[model samples]
Target: MLLADSPPPELQTLTRGQYDLVEYALAGAGFALLAYALYSWTSRSEVGVRYRPAVMLGLCVGAVAALSYLLLFLRWGAGYDLTDAGYVPTDQARLALSPRYVDWSVTVPLLTAELLAVCSLAGARARKLRASTMTAAFLMILTGHLGAQVVGEGRDTTALVLWGLVSTAFYGYLYVALIGAVRSSIPTIGREAAVSLRNAAIVLLATFGVYPLVYAVPVFVDVTAAWLTAIQLAYSAADVLAKVGFGVLVHKVAKLRTAEDVAAGVDTHPEAVWVSNVEHSRAVLPPAQPPAMATSPTTPTA
Candidate 1:
């Protein structure tokens, strides 16, 4: 059935106008953040080559998130109703399939990797942690996107609730993994870097918790355009915290690690002090002692 054939909700035009205004403002902010992230990535020489990859990953997270928000703004500005086309009769298509989900699907895993990478985990352990963390993060976002799809389709409340629960479970697992990864790195990366990484992870997890709350509100209560606006705004704020803010935090951790390496002289010479000494003495031998003759003379005198 055509959307025009069905009765529309009592949408306040003024509310939509306000939403548009807010979206535009957010878009501008997103652009600015994106620019900053790119600049940071490009100017990574400030942190030195050792930290470039980790810092680049963080910058990528910010850039991707800002791009996502800008896409959402464009979607909202286009006036395309989310509930425009669906098979279910009661499923009035209101939730526009905003590109936010698309963005999340790509960026979320990268964000997880970024968090883990800045810790400078070594060899096989780093690979394992990155794999596990990225897997969990990908699952978390996948389930959440699926749940959003179900809700957008006007599915039964029970279905929506179940999806929400599943997504939440994935999120819980993801958070635990993130914390574990950060904590495990303390012995390797030092307490300062570990603490910084932990704080960034916590900030991300905390901000992400708000998404489910914002999503649940509309599912259980009467939803209006204003409420939709609130959801968008809340999500935007969370994105900034989780992505841009977290990126900055990750950068700080990388910077700290770089400084520590420089101070320890590891950046220039990675060999242990004893090993360095051995290498230095390779061309020289200890002077031979006339020990046997000295001992014999002393014994005779006694």
Candidate 2:
């Protein structure tokens, strides 16, 4: 395993100090984010029931992200060193698994479903879209996780590169389905809500793109204290932006959709008749015109 041995004597003190500093800072930030998400969830009484699930899912995303960071912080704080292979404990503790990948295994699928649920139309189309998006998301994350595991297991670099390409392809498919296919259906919610959903997708795709770059850093640079620090910090920042920031945008879209429903005198109850009948629910708008399919050859290329 790379970095299985101690650092060179000249760098030992600096490495230890930097590790402690970064770990503590990340732990504190994780707790703070978790607290904020819980607070937001507790204060969600005013949100309409029809929109409540999406809001709750957003909070779930935040909570999962916080847990990932906290786990990493704890591992480092316990004297586990970040090696190219994985985390190695300095003492008698067992080897620590990668919390970030575990976090993604849970959160990525939920995130995909949340985004789709928020912008969903009130009919069969919604069901189909949600299922497809969720499946693609799961594939994307699974491939990425498997690739990382292969690399950590000392598999050939060629295997890692092939897996990376496979994962990237899956990710591309998800972007096409989410941003391309879903964008056409957003108008069923409301104009303002549609705008919000589009913006949210853009932000999420942009932030999520950073993960691959951070993951690839170790492949190019030697696994040193500074390299590990950069990986942790970059990933932490991406998590904050993708999960927490995207959650805020989702909340905004839900709020706007709820307001539109209220203005149109449409019941916002989860079991309301209009909730399942897209035609009736969207009656406030002009006679239903089929939304033009908007396909982008590239969409910020998530």
Candidate 3:
């Protein structure tokens, strides 16, 4: 049957204003994310080698998310038709959620990797922590997608709610892991670096919190034009902040720690910013002191 004839709960009829709003938001966010990803790419050379891994992960996250959003925008463009009332689905239609779920599955794990890269822990403990957190994040995205599929197939509120709760359980685990990582790293870095790391964690948590909120919308209200517009807008806003904004914040903390290490002579930066920093360091050094003993000592010895 045509989607218009038997529309899934995941698909919604949207007024022109609502459709335009979602379209613009997705396109704008895609461009913004790509820009930030490029920025992150260039910044990798500015930091110490030890912290480059986190910045690399952030770059990957941004690129993956940017591509997904752009694909979603294109899908939106082709999925619907301009009807008398507004925009409605064409014959064969599906929500652009598949791309989003695929994006989250990859990017979510990369985010956890980024966090762990900056973390102070090492060896087997670090490996264990990384494994658990990444696994939990992937499971969270997986379960959430299951909920969306439940909605797409049938308006099965019960299955959707159950899946949502399962996803929430995984999200809660990830939060615990993140908080622990932040708290543990505080004592290992300088005061400023610690503060930046802590703040990044807080902002990340706040931005990520928007996902569950967006996920729960279909649970609470019918997917009408206005509500659907709200959902798309919220998801787009959260995507930009969570991937691009959070990635930048993590990079800041990494850069700060690298600077701290360089200051203390614990780390060296041989690329990009280091060349200028080295010259500036030499310019500020005190002049060498004259020899205490004069040439007279050498004359007496002769």
Candidate 4:
């Protein structure tokens, strides 16, 4: 097993390649999420009003996260002075984390909203669940940010740990509430929506699990170049999954639900019937149009 001796950033002797890994991770996440956000925005017309909130939340989360990553990438580039020997940290190094907090603060609340949007709740129940989870998500991110600030300021580790614990309580609430809501909603929804929503929950559980581990890194290990590289990579990848990946899955659930509704003869968006055709084909449901329509000769007019 490799042990981190915990060399401070200035003394770490970080090579250009190692430095590039961190920079590229931030930039890659930014661009990918921005693209996803645009895709979500354009796809708005494809889903019905019932599930549109889910898609909209995805767009908002992806957009905010993309901007945050852009800031992080630029901040990372500016924070390092590339010398022949290695990369050295500048005064701007600490500023990189600010964008990270900003990303979390906005995206976290929005994530819960999207999750609720796909659930099978309604009326006051829906409103109540949304409020509770969104509040928890916001507090979770806020306390986590405060804890990180405590750590960054070289304050008492006890206070840092305390904040971490408090943040963790909110995190636990968010995780449990999200998972519970998703699981409960699964049995009540259509087949395609259920599967995608279940998958989204699984992905949510996975990506949510990754964050605190990354957040806890500084507490246990020395943030050497290797550790920082790992942290950047882990956090960036997690953000992509939790934001972009989650968005895609949420959209898929909403899309499939729209398909089910349209298949059931409900009036919806103009493109909904075609979207249903495609999704129903994938789900092995009854074909919206006969296969003969594509290959067979046209029937004579009446």
Candidate 5:
């Protein structure tokens, strides 16, 4: 049946306009940053010629990841029937209420980007790291997709059983890959501890800080309007946090592109000899300091 045909729920809810305004605004900002990063990377990329496929794959995955979320919203909006007894909420309502679609959409693109990033890293000489990254990316997508599917659809035992198996496997992979990535990416005690601590803190906050205030109160608050509003608000807040985090992550990745260029330049130029030697001894090379210029007496120093 068409979305318009869906039964109306008893709830007199806000219009789509009411719901999506913030999402659209944040998404716009997110896209703008992505565009800038892509442009910057393309312009500065030295090995651009070699990693064209990887880049394209990353973009494609990114698009897919984005589509996943869009699909969720579309499904959520479509699922609800606001006029019906149970609120024959269109799929869109279902999507929003469930959170699966958003999860899948977000995770898929991230996984794709990550896989491509791993490939790029491998291309740049982090062979072990690349392998680990790819494995982790794949598992994240797999489990994330399964979890999303399970949550989005209505109750079905067989479907759950089948998807549950897939989910389990994927989750297992996620654990293994995450461990591997961390182990390979950071070689120092302090750095590893810091990274671990930071991630743990973020997860802790998401669970303890933002979740209860915005989400949990609704169930106990015992007013339908209050509950829905609280839930929606919670989701909106989460979305904002996610976009902000992703924007920062992408920016960091963009910075890495510059680092990669510097690395590539060193490899091709005469200075690589020293850097390469340093990498072998300490497993840490000095930051790729830009070529120090000979300041001539008459040259205007910027």
Candidate 6:
């Protein structure tokens, strides 16, 4: 069967009303988690320009993915009456445009822009890896954006070609950039690596674990399919949970890194360090001596 000919077995049988409820539940859960993560990051105020933008971009992509899924499968899904007209072309178009396309346009570009900005800033500081990182990020964002357009739009020939091109680029950049960062982090690479890798893993797991149900929908039993849809919704909710959880982790790790710097007497804040250094230097220096006078002349005259 053509991928589009039949609704995925997972999504096929649910009543529109039921799906709406599921969508709402998922959206609320996902948004909450994402928001919490952002808040946690904001609280730290220790975020470097590079990591700060990267974090926000990651959050944006994750959150948008969740939102798009909810709107496509639930809100718009409700427009089709199960007993009457099922999913329609217009519905598909709406789904494609509002959430999916929007996500595509926004997520990748925002990520790329932030990465470029960060990389540029880091480059100014002479970080050797900045150029490569910026390049990778830019390419990934471009590809992810293209893939989204294809899936959302459903124009087969063009969509397939575009998706293949962009997805490949995205994956390539993703691997290179990540591996490079990991290698650079060194000694503690495994621990630091978890931050970005774990998040990506969470997103992939969520996507695969949740999205295929629509494929299974046509073949499965209606009640069973509904249950699976419900399960998928839960999985999406878990995505948000992971984000917030990771956010908390990021915030804590940042704190620990900061504390370590302080304990080791390595000052990360240049301004503060400069001021302290100046004060210390002033305290240590001896007071200036008065200039000597020609005392011999005065004695002779007396």
TM-score of each: 0.74, 0.75, 0.85, 0.85, 0.45, 0.52
Q: Sort all candidates by lDDT, best to worst.
A: 3, 4, 2, 1, 6, 5
> For candidate 4, which ten residues in a row score worst on lDDT?
278-287
Go through the candidates in order and give the clash count of each: 4, 0, 0, 0, 31, 10
Best by lDDT: 3
Better of 4 and 6 by lDDT: 4
Ten contiguous residues minimizing lDDT sum, candidate 1: 273-282
Show the colliding residue pairs in model 6.
8-214, 8-215, 8-217, 9-215, 9-216, 9-217, 9-218, 10-213, 10-216, 10-217
Which stretches in model 2 have alpha-carbon errors above 4 Å?
1-14, 80-97, 151-155, 189-191, 219-223, 268-302
Give the residue spans of candidate 4 off by over 4 A: 1-13, 151-155, 273-302
lDDT of 5 by residue, 170-253 (tens): 445545544444345444223323353235324422422343243223222333433454455555455434333433333333
Question: Candidate 3 lDDT (Cα, whole model)?
Answer: 0.78
Tens digit per residue, CA lDDT, model 3, 1-302: 11224345336677899889989999999999999899999778766778899999988988999889988988888888889988887643475556788999999888888888887988998899899989999999899888766454525667678888999999999899889988998998878668777877887778778888877765666555576677778888988888777777778778777777766766665532333234211112234688896554445553
lDDT value for candidate 6? 0.44
Please give the distance, in angstroms, between residue 61's alpha carbon in candidate 6 and its true position after superposition: 6.7
Mind giving the per-residue lDDT tens digits that candidate 1 earns over 223-265? 5555655666676777777777787777777766765665565
Q: Candidate 2 lDDT, tens digit per residue, 167-265? A: 788788878877865577575777767877888898888887987776555444445656556656677777777777787777777666666776677
What's the TM for model 6?
0.52
Model 6 residue runs over 4 Å out of place are 1-13, 16-21, 46-93, 96-98, 108-152, 155-162, 188-242, 268-302
Model 4 Cα displacement at 72 (Å)? 0.9
